[model samples]
Target: MALCLLSPGQGSQSPDMLARLAADPATAGTLATLAPLAGDEALRVAADPARCFANRHAQPLLCLYALAVGAALSAEGVEAALVAGYSVGELAAYGLAGALPAAAVLRAAAARAQAMDDCAPADSGMLAVRGVAIGEIEALAAAHGVDVAICNGDEHAVLAGPQCALDALATTLAAQRGAHVVSLPIGVPAHSRWLQPAVAPFAATLAALPWQRGALPVLAGVSAEPVRAPERAVETLSRQLAATIDWARVLDVAVEMGTTVFFEVGPGNALARMARERHPGLPARALADFASVAGAAAWLRRQLA
Candidate 1:
């Protein structure tokens, strides 16, 4: 079976997200290398509910968590045929694909978070809206001065802008029958033109990194195209910082590429859930759902067998 690895973004983080990885001896070395790169307070922030979701802490920690899990799965001989990530998780996807070293991915994630924090306007954030038509969401976003950040599906999208504007849009959508809106914990209006200022600097940061074609192809979030070359990877990685992400297309293209199994390496299982929801007949599971890396690997092996 061809396997696709899914990496989740910020909203998937939880207080105890790293506990399992930290306790696994198989991943001890990876955590040792990445935790320091993430920050002196990385573990502390991860364990603190209030601070963990902050972009500065969340980005690197989530990338580090995904890399550590990917490493452990690799050690078990579980290989991915393709990989994709949502938002900040895309950095981890590069590392998982071997385009960048794991440590570099953590460092890049830190720099990315810092750049976004520096460029993003204060009090700006994201909101997930579902059960509403995409056109209606776009119209509401235009009316409320927000931008559509991500298109998760035909009816599910995420909007980003000043918190006040997001609140206004949320208020408008709340009145619609069968509509659902939730304010994300993210502090930056990621994947919107509001973050355009972050694009060049982060591009330079990615360009400076040592890169190589990896064992598998990574689907670009911005275009849903397979990225195999380093130059293209850098371009898409940076451009995605300020462009809308077509995650719905990414999922569609993964299926079209013959992905028979979807496994999420993550701090949470949101990506896996999305995959299963979008392709119910496909086998999909998240590392977070298993008690151990071995268990997850075994399940993946079973699917492939």
Candidate 2:
């Protein structure tokens, strides 16, 4: 069976997210390699939601977690022919696909997070809205000075703008029937017009970096198309910072590409849940759901067989 690896973005992090992986001896080397990038007392930082929620800490930590999990699975001979990531997770996807080395991937992730954080105002944040039509959400966003950051599907999306505006939108949506809005812990208005200032610098940084073609195809988060060239990869990644992501389409592209089995190599099961919701028949599981890397690998091997 052809397998697709899914890397998750922000909003799924928790205090004990990486405890199981950290306890595994096989992940020692991978954790060591990522420790410096994750900062002093990395696990301590991860255990604190307030500190880890910052863009500076969250980006690198998420990338490290995904890379470590993927490495452990690979060691067990779980093969994924295709890969995709959501937002910041794309950097980890590049590393998983062999498009960037470990050092380079962490460096890029740090830089990307810093750049986006710089563009984000202290009062700006994101909100996830569901059970409301995209058109209605767009209308609300236009009325509230917020922008649609991501279109998860026809009736679900994430909005980004000033925190006050999001609060106002939430209040308004609360009044409407069948409308739901949840404020995300993140403070940055990522993937929105507010981050437009960060695009040029991030693109320049990617261009200056030494890049190698990846061994596996990575579906672009913005377009869901297979990106084989480093140039295209850089462009898509940079542009996505200020563009709305169509994640539903990305899932469709994965199925169209013959992905029968899926693995989410990250701290949470958000990606896997989304995939299963979109395609109930597809076999999808998250590494975080397993008690050990070996258990996850065995499950994958069973699916392939």
| Model 1 per-residue lDDT tens digits across residues 186-216 | 9999999999999999999999998976547
State each model's CA lDDT, in order: 0.91, 0.87
Question: Which candidate achieves the best lDDT against the true structure?
Answer: 1
Best by TM-score: 1
State, as a TM-score between 0 and 1, how close model 2 is to the true structure.
Answer: 0.96
- Please provide, for model 2 over 157-184, each residue's C-alpha lDDT reduced to its tens digit, 9 standing for 90 to 100: 8999999999989988878645888999
Each prediction's number of clashing residue pairs = 0, 0
Error of 2 at 285 (Å): 1.0
Candidate 1: misplaced stretches above 4 Å?
none
Model 2 steric clash pairs: none
